[model samples]
Target: MKIILKVLLYIVLGILALCISEMLFFFILIHSNNTEKGNKTVIMKTDSIAHSKALVVYQPSLMTDSTKNVAYDLAKGLNSKGYDVTIAYPGKYLSTDLSTYKVVVFGSPIYIGQTSSVLNDYIKSVNNLKDQKILLFVTGGADDSEQLNSLEKLFTNAEIPMKISFKYNDKGNENKAFNLGSEIGKE
Candidate 1:
């Protein structure tokens, strides 16, 4: 009976050690991911909006809602400049004809170093965009050079108004969005 008890105790100790090690590993991984975000050098440009009608079509991050994203700030900035901006999530059924807008802004969150598939599909579906002015922006935790290159290649005729990658919990990027809007509005 004593031998059985000793074995049971040893088993319990071993299980406890395994659990502790797993927990430590998970904690370390989480810490490292939070501490190390890759290079975040996102570059963008904006052209003046000659017409008042503007549409901001965007896809929110998987982890964040539309209100807490750079797209929302970009729309707010455009609105502040009196561009008659309409912000819509690309997943929704929109009654507005995208081609009618004088300046169309496309925003997306970079996932796995690329733009989400939904945004890509939405862009492809839009028609009559050859003459319309286009603006593009992306949000991500790190510099998404691959995503930018892919998007630039895809939207060969579109102008990249601004490219910004904001880290988690960053609130200071609104000014950049506002400035981009102002630059567009000025023209």
Candidate 2:
């Protein structure tokens, strides 16, 4: 009986150590610098000169390309609707002057049920978006309703007409994001 108790105690201690390590790792990741390595902006403009303008700002995830793919797909959809779309990464280089845009979209990847600080900081820095047609998107492993709610709360100052959560493994996520962008561009 004593030997069994010792084995159980060791197992519990091991689990506790693992949980602590995971938490530490998460903290480090969240606080680390997240500068995107590639091109900061991708423009998708229509042929017409009278096309409306749309902006998509997103923080790409290091673990997966899901967020970046969704942003590009969304831009493509907006471009199809005759809107000049500019897809950008959230950073110092991105211009916050959104006066010329008819529509603005912000996207982030959910990690441990929270959006990245880079996106949150960028959103806070931009001003005068109360009347803008703002759309939001988040990519994660699951569609957690609580996370969506929190994301909405983060953008409470803006008029978010549409907000969506895309699961990483979902096959139809790209199409869904594109459709959402197309719908928003029509407005």
For each candidate in turn, the TM-score is: 0.64, 0.81
Q: For model 1, how does the per-residue alpha-carbon lDDT over 47-155 read when each residue is reduced to its tens digit?
A: 4354366777776554555323566666666666666777766653653357666677777765456675656666766765665667777767787666766765666
Q: Give one digit per residue, the lDDT tens place, for model 2 in 107-163.
A: 888877778677777787787787678888888887656766676677646767788
Off by over 4 Å in 2: 1-39
In model 1, the runs with Cα more than 4 Å from the true position are 1-51, 65-68, 156-162
- The local lDDT score (0 to 100) that residue 16 gets in candidate 2 is 100
Q: CA lDDT, every prediction?
A: 0.62, 0.81
- The alpha-carbon lDDT assigned to residue 98 of candidate 2 equals 87
Each prediction's Cα RMSD? 9.5, 3.2
Model 1, residue pairs in steric clash:
45-161
- Model 1 lDDT-worst window of ten: 36-45
